[model samples]
Target: MSTGPLNPETSTSLPSPPFVHLKGIPNFRDLGGYKVAGSDLIVRRGYAFRCGEPTSATPEAIETIRGLGINHIFDLRSLPEIQKMQVAGTGPKTVDWPGVTRVFTPVFREESYDPVSLAKRHADYQSEGSEGMVNAYRTILTEGANSYSIILRHILEDARRSKNTAETALIFHCTAGKDRTGVLGALLLSLCGVPDEVVAEEYNLTEAGLGEWTELLVQAVLKQGAASEEGARRMVGARKDSMINTLAMLRDEFGGPENYIVTKCGLTEAEVAEIRHFLVVGE
Candidate 1:
């Protein structure tokens, strides 16, 4: 149980210093080096990474991922999407990423991911704006804990066996790395004592990190769905107010992130503490 924050003066910004340019992987970034408000601690880098789908990852992209020493990947897409990715492979039709394990713990496991239904849902929210985001995130927080519990259990197990979390650093992502992945990132960063503002900022980076993929998605939604241009963009945009509202919901209704994990996610307090230690190491 480390109550102390990570000291950045003497520590590298990231566990794997010198960010490399990654091709074919959109919205990929290490979750580290962030200054938690009113503390000397920064979020430890390299232990966690958030990215978009990896099926389109190039061989060079795979090398960059391998270089991170990311031993595990948590995919938040449903069974249908996971099956599609397995057939899609890691870029080339048949290439597989050796050594690293890919785990599927779908955020919407039982719910069918039908394109017509998904489009209709987005169309239904065309005028809702941040309200839609707020409702969507609330559902994610309420029902998605079971999916997250799987990752947390693995993280605790790994932390118990080793002090160095970097050797076994892991990634978690959904298709666009925005909604489901953003909530997961926010929870992890909050547990590390990052401020709500900082958490929102980190979440908002999803669009920029998505780069070309962002526009492509917006176009696809506009063409295939009945959503307005704003609504189409909203589907991919990580507006700060949405996350702010979600964090407030997390605190007010869920009794804060820690309690949420302990009660809803089925993690013990001791396991949660160990995960915090593994994620935030002092210099």
Candidate 2:
């Protein structure tokens, strides 16, 4: 239950696991307990969470989420991904989090479902280990800035309205609760002064968070002779190095996450500070 600074870089810590293994909701977990760099502060638990599509969450799970004091549930899946898919996990989300407001926030704009492009991306994953995760991270932060900003602003505003960040906990997710969700998670952690490497490790935890869906995703990622089992696994899995490279890109290109959110996402300095303050606790 306790997770503090493991080191300045490299967040390989397991004093306790952080995932919430709710039935039917893969990768559902708390996004807290991270230690902030150069301080004794740790990110507050029960304040933020991440998960995959929750359409399959059981009623009991919905009740659990409701009791978590969640003020908003941000759905970051693209419209097509959320509304058009026929698959069980990838399809439109139908389960609601009790009475919590579900904000349909698509972090990606609609685009033609180009099979060739997706195949090429998978090929890139096989040929290249990181599968161009840096670019993907960058695209979501930049091109998807508006949607991300909305999520951030809403969290801050809701906290103001409720006058309690803990009661205003926000849960956000994409299809697998990794890629797009991972990027936003990293940003928030980094804003709380988490080291870049540790942030990457947080992003990397998605592999385990995906739980049994790992095989399903690997199978779905595999396309006729496109990649070996290992390669397809790599495509479906969240690599720490990919997230590390993404963190480096954020530092080298965007001057770390704080500046990126301010310059690109258009959040005011006070708003960003308030979010950081709420996230990190203990002096």
TM-score of 2: 0.86
Q: Write the per-residue lDDT of candidate 1 for residues 215-281, one digit (tens) a residue.
A: 5666655665745777777666788877888898889888988999999999889989988887776
What lDDT does model 2 reach? Answer: 0.69
Q: After superposition, how far is residue 107 of candidate 2 from its true place, in Å?
A: 1.2
10 residues in a row with least lDDT, candidate 1? 1-10
Work out the TM-score per prediction: 0.84, 0.86
For each candidate, how many residue pairs have backbone atoms clashing (under 3 Å)?
A: 1, 0
Pairs of residues at least 3 apart in sequence or in different chains that clash in candidate 2: none
* Stretches > 4 Å off in candidate 2: 1-17, 86-91, 112-122, 162-165
